[model samples]
Target: MKLNHSVTGQDQGLPIMLVHGLFGQGRNLGAIARRLSEQRRVILVDQRNHGDSPHDPDHSYAAMAGDLAEVIGAFGGRVDLAGHSMGGKAAMHLALTQPELIRKLAVMDIAPVAYAHSQNHLVDAMAAMDLQGVVRRSEADRRLSEHIHDTGLRAFLLQSLDLKSDPPRWRLNLPALRDWMDRTTGWPEGLPKGIFDGPALFMAGAESDYVDDAGEAAIREYFPQARLLRIKHAGHWMHADAPEAVAETLSAFMGGG
Candidate 1:
């Protein structure tokens, strides 16, 4: 599959790829990439079934990992990788499956263990929107508010909604994503064996339950060199909540500072 991506700082230094979570596109990390662009080549990728990437009914960590591998290969061998939530899991799988293709790995606010399907409400809310009759983004926002309580989350999800001049179209493949919510949330079982010895950083939001004691063993099993860092007062979206901290940590890690 030809993965969709936006490249920044291409001529600066070593390449670093940014992968976003579920319901997120490459641009979600635009800020971080721009900040890091001063010293590194940043590649923000939109994983399959999301953003402008090709949509397929099958969405799994293995498939997503394969997609990432292809992107890395296109970059001329290995590159540093950073991912959040769902993207974090896929990054881990990719590093483990193709260790030689990843220079360094950073996983934000997500564990390697299998996550239970908890985003069903969000999926249902997104699916319930009357896309056909929706006249404006505000109208869609108003209707979505009934099902989604968090105004911020509603706005974040709605970022996928793009209005084209030619008859207006929704860029995201909502139905396909909604139908494979389980696959998107689930973890791949079993590994080929051994660990990815490359330097790895496991960043967790202080207030997020995504990375807890329960998932530590699984993380260590695959990424034995992984080091954990917690950003204060942040939730699942640590990068958005604490951009400065994330940028500092990432810059240091990638630059070997």
Candidate 2:
């Protein structure tokens, strides 16, 4: 399917595949990938329906997992996988569904359980932007500021905007994303029983609500061998917020050091 990816480092070592969160592209993890590249091959993948990948009506973890498997197959099978938020959930699904394709797994700041509908404000803010009349990216930023007060969040969302020869346009499929909002926010149900016994890493931002003390039991249930790491003073985007800490943790886990 020609899934968009950014590869770094030497190709000889164990390949590490990165999957980004909702509203994020492969480039979101570019910094992390570059750092990890020194010792390992890193491939940052843009999940379907999000970045430069093909868009489809299907938005569930099952479909996303399959898409991940396809990408892995293209890479000659077997990879160390790491994901954040929605991508984290998808990585879990991939590990559980296609165990053979994954060497080890890392899920950042997300539990296996279905998340509540808390992203409504973000969705509303994106939808409220008049895409048709948007002449400049700055104007879009101004409009987003009315609904999303956080400048960081507004800037993160606006990264998807790009200029084409004809006119400025949004690379993301906003309408499809909006339609599948519920599916994206929620987790997939009904896994056959039994945990993914392979090595797993569960990383959470200490200040993030995405993973809490109460969620540990469920996370352990699915990933029995999973080791949890917490990055202090970081929010949902821990990898970006604390790249050095995240990189250290990931390197240790990957190397079994």
Candidate 3:
């Protein structure tokens, strides 16, 4: 599917594509994109089933990676790809399956291994939300609060709420996400055995357990040239917690330095 995307910066060398995580849109990485765009073109992509992208029943990493491949080919044959969380996994899968499409790969706060955590609760909360007579984001927030206590996370999810659409509705495909929860948090079986020997960056948040020892091992197994780094005082969403650091580090990784 042709995913929704926005491009900035000059048509210089290979573009840098930024992909967001679950429950996030491309604009979530706007800060990083802005910094990188100064040196090269940046493609902010709304992965399928999120943002303005077309939603499909399949949300597997392979499918997601395929969607990204389409976007990359449309912009240019090759790109320097960076993705956070779910987007990071998709980026890795693309690089593994089709290395020619990627000039460099950056995986932020994620590993190529399956995670035990389940985001079904968030999907359930969003699915159970009563949009009836709710005209304001606050009202929706108030209802979602019963299930989700994290104020920041609730606010983040609320970004996808379409308030102008008559009675209002979430732009996310909650059912598809919930149904495909396992695949969303899993690494596809029988992946390509070969490694992506291109320049790779595996950045983890110091406070985040997303990329643990096992994750680091997996990184080296698949990307021998991978450079590992950790952002201080940042959690899983390092881009938000330390936008400047994330942006600067990513800019340098993509050769913006």
Candidate 4:
């Protein structure tokens, strides 16, 4: 599947590829991508079934990882990879399955283990919205309030709504995403034990339980060369909540790794 993407920066050295969280487009990480682009080619990608990417029935991590592989093959042979949330999970799967294609891996606010948090309701909430019936963003916002009360979260999800569409369409394949939420939150089944010896950075949000001391054990086991960092005043969406810290850490990894 040809995924939607945008490239920035022309400086030499290894390129950086960034993947965004669920319900987010590649441009979600534009700020960080632009910063890294100053010294390296940065490719911001919109994962399958999201953003402008064509919708597919399957939404497993393996499938998502494969889409990323196809993307890298088109851009370059290998790259420094950074992913957040669901994107982080896809990055881990790609690195573990194809270590040669990745020079270094950076996983933000996610671990190699299955998450206890259930985001299915978020999917359900989005699915419940009748985009065709709504004519204005305010009505959509009001309907969304029935499921989500957080202002920031509503804004995030609403970004996928194509307001100008004749019938008002969603950029995301809601059903596919809803069906795959469990798999997205769960680690791949029967994955090989091959360790990615290449350096990896696992950044956790200070307020997010996505990665904790117990989870670090799994990360270290899968990526023996992995190191952890915690960004202050952030939640599961650290890249959005703490852009400067995330960019600094990513730049350090790209330059030093």
> Once all C-alphas are superposed, what RMSD does model 2 give against the true structure?
1.9
Give the Cα-based TM-score of candidate 2 against the true structure: 0.93
Write model 4 residue lDDT over 3-104, tens digit each, in one string. Answer: 899988874677789999899999899889878887888899999999999999999998999999998898667889999989999999999999889999
lDDT of 2 by residue, 4-102 (tens): 877888777568998999889999888888777878888898888776788777677888898888889987798999999999989999888888898
Worst 10 residues of 2 by lDDT: 162-171
Candidate 3, superposed: residue stretches over 4 Å from native: none
The alpha-carbon lDDT assigned to residue 25 of candidate 1 equals 95
Q: Comparing candidate 2 with candidate 4, which one achieves the higher TM-score?
A: 4
Question: Which candidate leads the pack in TM-score?
Answer: 3
- How does model 1 score by TM-score? 0.93
TM-score of each: 0.93, 0.93, 0.97, 0.95
In candidate 4, how many Å is residue 163 off? 0.8
Compared to the true structure, candidate 3 yields what TM-score? Answer: 0.97
Q: Where does the lowest 10-residue lDDT sum fall in candidate 4?
A: 188-197
Residue 18 displacement (Å), model 1: 0.3
Clashes of each: 0, 0, 0, 0
By summed lDDT, the worst window of 10 consecutive residues in model 3 runs over: 188-197
